[model samples]
Target: MRFLVQRVSDSSVEINGEVVGQIGKGFMVLIGVCDSDTKEIADKMVRKMLGLRIFEDEQGKTNLSLDTVGGQLLLISQFTLYANCKKGNRPSFIEAGEPGMAEEMYEYIIARCKEQVEVVERGQFGADMKVSLTNDGPFTIILDSEQL
Candidate 1:
């Protein structure tokens, strides 16, 4: 499992020209599931996302968790996160989980996030979607479960 976490002032996802999900003052999480990913990986990622202290506190220190800041979450399924380009110009997604498992993990993450945040919005799992966000502090973090 992997995640691209960006602190955002606002974020939204649209599919087929219709707004699907949106959030404000939160983190936009681009999630990728690998073939080995299981419910354990999904659970771990959700816990880390909710607990990561990247938001600013009263002293202007980046010490507040999402819950402390009352922030939302925008989760987007992005298998491209697992792209492997070592062999050629084109990237290979062979490391990513198949559609069925990927979709299951994606939905599981969303359900878990909804329980901990003020709001948890999600992009269409396998749809052509457009995502927009205003990055807060220009802070971006890339996380991989295997690294942890």
Candidate 2:
């Protein structure tokens, strides 16, 4: 599993020109799942992501967690995060989880997120999505399960 976390002022996902999910003042996370990913790994990743204190506080210090700031969430499934480009110009998705299992994991992550976040929005799994966001601070973090 891998989480590409981007702190955003606002974010939205569209499919066929219809907006599906959106959030404000929160993290727009692109979640990637691999064959070895488990619920435990997902749990740990979510914990690390939620615990991140990248948001600035009153003192202009980056000292606030998502909970402290009452932030929402916009989660999207992105298998491309696991794309392997070591061999050629084209990327290979062989490291990404199979569709069925990946979708299940994706849904599980969203449900787990909803348990902590008051507003957890998500894009449709396997859909052709157009995502838009205003990256706050242009701040981003990549959380890989292997590193965690």
Candidate 3:
């Protein structure tokens, strides 16, 4: 499992020209599930996304977690995060999990995240969606389950 987390002031996702999900003042999560990913890894990543202290404190220090600031969550499924491009011009997605399994893990992560935040909005899984966001502090981090 892997995730690209970006702190955003506001974000929205549209599928086929219809708004699907949106959020304000939280992290925009682009999640990718690998063939080896399991529920354990998804759970661990959820905890980290909720607990990671990327928000600023009263003193202007980046020391507060999203929970402290009362933020929302915007989660999106993005298998391209695992793209393998070393071999050729066209990126290969052989490392990405099958659609069904990936969808299960994606839903699991979203359900888990709701426990820590006021709201958790998500894009349609496997859809060609349009995502927009005003990145806050331009703060971004990448988390991989294998690294843990």
Ranking by lDDT: 2, 1, 3
Residue 74 displacement (Å), model 1? 0.6
In model 3, the Cα lDDT at residue 119 comes to 90
Residue lDDT tens for model 2, 30-114:
9999999999999999999999999999999999999999999999999999999999799999999999999999999999999
Candidate 3 positional error at 77, Å = 0.3
| Residue range 19-83, candidate 3, lDDT tens digits | 89999998999999987899888888888778899999889999999989998899999999999
Kindly provide the TM-score of model 1 when superposed on the true structure, using C-alpha atoms.
Answer: 0.97
Regions of model 2 farther than 4 Å from truth = none
Q: Against the true structure, whose lDDT is highest?
A: 2
Worst 10 residues of 2 by lDDT: 37-46
Q: How much RMSD separates candidate 1 from the native structure?
A: 0.8
Better of 2 and 3 by lDDT: 2
lDDT of each: 0.92, 0.97, 0.91
User: Of models 1 and 2, which has the larger TM-score?
Assistant: 2
Instruction: Give the lowest summed-lDDT range of ten residues in model 3.
Output: 109-118
